[model samples]
Target: MSTVNILHMKQGDGEMSYAKNSTIQMRWMNMALPIVKNTIKEMLTIHLTSFEKLESFKIVDIGCGSGPNTLLFMSEIIDTFYNLSNQNNHQSPEISIVLNDLYKNDFNNIFNALPLFYEQLKEKYGHEFSQRCFISVVASSFYERLLPSKSLHFVHSSSSLHWLSQVPENLDNKGHIYMAKDCLPIVFDAYKNQFNKDFYSFLNKRSQEIFPKGKMILTLLGRSIPEPSSNDGCCLWELLAQSLLDMVSQGLVKKEDVDSFNLPFYTPYCDEVKEIVMKENSFDLDKIEVYMCNWDPNDDEDDDNNIFDKKKSGENIVKRIRVVSESMLVTHFGELPLDTVFKIFAERVANHLEMEKTKYTNLTICLKKK
Candidate 1:
């Protein structure tokens, strides 16, 4: 199945939901706040001066999964506008916010939270500000067009663009779901080619929807190292692959099943992202920065001695991995193995972290529609 059909964050606010297990993403969002704030400030300064001529200011959060983070973004945008409006004594333009994610995302959760979201916004920014904001959801992949021509002024996505529209075709890495240190060269080529195609398509489509000079901010998994299979870049998937191989050894899962399964994901290097953006020729790259984040950002509970708590750290990482990947794994491996597989996967991650702290490089980019 295509990722568009199957890939979605775990739904709802329950223990296993993406909403519950998204602290890492929350941290990423927080990291991007300065860029978001500055970008909004600049956009508003330039675009809102002619507020009388505009119908509404449209901002979109691409791949906006359910819950607090999505609503948090809405609040941030409104608050930014509120502050700017106050400074200029300008009436805030009618605001239109669209949240975009895969077709399978739990938009109902977002919609259901609207009452509380608006209530909080009203309390924070007053009824006039809240009343001016309108919210909508679009269930679609960002690789494809999600809006009309020249409709959006700002687009923001965090920790989402790493997902390709589908797994690379004809992958033959054998037992690996992602690039590995010793994978055949063809495997690397296939993955890189897929990302180039998907990313170009994403840029091409977005170019049609955003007005000239509109801003797009994207924060996604990436690599600082040049090697595609570097441990820092692919260690999470490597450990997950090892866990699956362990199951294969126990006769719990078929070897062929593991061999055939590949994640519809890729983490590009900073230069790779720049290359594609330049090649696409649709958006001007404004800024790109890479940052490293721990596999478990909430691992501060360690003792003064700094002994590694394998189980605690493993559980934290496990919750995050499970929330983002359970749907894909369950689809490929059946629901029976979900608990067992991740249990093994978590233990393997713990062992790896015990040996050396594993970090993921995140790439944040600012783009302007050309």
Candidate 2:
């Protein structure tokens, strides 16, 4: 089976859909707003100032996943461009959008959302918005070259690049699905090598596609420290492993199945990202920052470690996880154990949170083509 077949988020806009559970993803995108706003202004001043408004300006969203936020984010970005252009007394330029992702991504959901999305843009910017905006899709992988040479301006992505092209070879990550405390040296080495290789190739490809001054803002699930096994980085999987082990004890899941599975996901440290960018040498690292959010996207735990209503928080976190992971998990563990494993996972998460607070850490990386 294809990788896309195995890795898509839950489809539809139902309660359990990525559309419903993407508050965390939206928050990550919104956190990049200050940088995004600055980028648009710079693009307007530097590039659009010399061009005819009738000419098309292209932007690409690499790994633009499904959810209501898919078009919502793109529309807001266009609005930013036009609004900033208006401020500078420039005519509106045709905005061409290229939405690229794996084959099985829920492009249908994104397509269904378009009428309303266009209406919202009309509501805000009127009929002119319709003429100035163009949207297209390339059903392919970012790990391969997806666009023409120097064909892109102001590229963007979020919660994407951390996914390796494939799972690492020869994982002996028995009993754990990801990097964790006490994970063997070989396991760590496999993950590190895979990420390094995939990421360098990704940069080399993207470097060719973006214009000389084109910028990319990539936000990913990542860590504040260099260690992949750190609490904020790998604790989520460790907890998931504990839940799977509990299931094994109950005979609800096979011990061997639990032992052999490992996620194709990695959350890199800021320094790790810096080294890769430096090694690639195709882009200048403008800014890279680490930010933390509560594991429960909706958690208002405030400045303290207080997690009131632990059970509710646990459900929230697990539901968020389920939307992203359910398909691959069901394929590996079968549909029957789905609810049971997740229920156990939620309980484990609540208990773990009760002991101490752990926030999800992420990296927002900004780059300029060199």
Instruction: Provide the lDDT at 32 for model 1.
Output: 87
By summed lDDT, which 10 consecutive residues of candidate 2 come out lowest? 1-10
Deviation from native of the Cα of residue 124 in model 2, angstroms? 1.8
Clash counts for the predictions, in order:
0, 0
> How many clashing residue pairs, candidate 2?
0
Q: Please give the distance, in angstroms, between residue 26's alpha carbon in candidate 2 and its true position after superposition.
A: 1.2
* Model 1: ten consecutive residues of lowest lDDT: 1-10
lDDT of 2 by residue, 252-328 (tens): 88989988877787888888888999999999999987899999877885648754788999999998888777876
What number of backbone clashes does candidate 1 have, counting pairs of residues 3 or more apart or in separate chains?
A: 0
lDDT of each: 0.75, 0.74
TM-score of each: 0.90, 0.91
Q: How far is candidate 2 from the true structure (C-alpha RMSD, Å)?
A: 5.8
